[model samples]
Target: MTIRPIVRYPDPRLALPAQPVTVFDGALRELASDLLETMHAAPGIGITAPHIGISLRVVVLDLDPVDGARTYVNPEIIWASPEMILHQEGSVSMPGVNDDIRRHARVRIGYRDIDGNAQTEESGGLRAVCHQHEIDQLNGVFWIQRLSRLKRERLVKRFEKLSRG
Candidate 1:
């Protein structure tokens, strides 16, 4: 397993829709391992395949305060409650900034596990928010996208300025 570099915001790849993983081959397994390593190295709770330049519907998350991790392949949000919560969210791709984003407090997700078994998990609070955030990355969406147009523009400018220096 290797730590892969994260794709930054405003990159074209971040806006490209990821393809579904059809073959559970060794390469796919390696990619998952690499993603986990990368996420852990980033000290982040979640990561998506596209974040490492792999445009596939794969994500790794370690929301457990304990020592466990969850890998999701082709994950889909099956259900979400109307009750919402706002949390200050940050991304490894967009360093040095965080924004409060509104998201469902609870969600039911369906996906295949690492062993190729189908499973569903009902998550809430931080888990729910993390899952939704990672899933959004799989679909070419980012937390900043939830911000207002003016705010997004300001962030873009900020990112641009930071990149220059």
Candidate 2:
């Protein structure tokens, strides 16, 4: 697996909706492997296909080293609880900037495995937050877009400064 360059923030691709994976083949597996490597290099807990200029609906998450990694294909949120939680959300695309964003405390998502098997996961806490965050990205809604206008502007400025320095 190769570590691919992450697509930076404000890139038009990050705002474009990703297409569902139509074929589950070796190339798909390789892409997932590459995503894991790239996420690790980015030092991010999660990443999506669009994060690396791949317009496919795939996500790789490794919240715990012990748990290893998980690949979600064409993931869609099937359910979300009314309870909300505030979690600090950042992106591999926009490194060095983060903000607490409100998200569902619990979520259930349906997705396919790398081998094309269907899977559903119910999660709470950080896992739930990740599910929502990455799924939003697949829908072309960057994490900062969920922030208040003032907060989004401030975070973008901070990211810009970091990029320059």
Best by lDDT: 2
lDDT per residue for candidate 1 within 1-34, as digits (tens), equals 9988998886889887899888887888899999
Q: For each candidate, what TM-score against the reference?
A: 0.93, 0.99
Candidate 2: tens digits of C-alpha lDDT, residues 1-165: 999999998999999999999999999999999999999999999999999999999999999779999999999999999999999999999999999999999999999999999999999999999999999999999999999999999999999999999
Best by TM-score: 2
RMSD of 1: 1.4
Worst 10 residues of 1 by lDDT: 90-99
Pull out the clashing pairs in model 1. Answer: none
Over 4 Å off, model 2? none
Candidate 2 residue 107 Cα shift, in angstroms, is: 0.3
Candidate 1 clash figure, as a count: 0
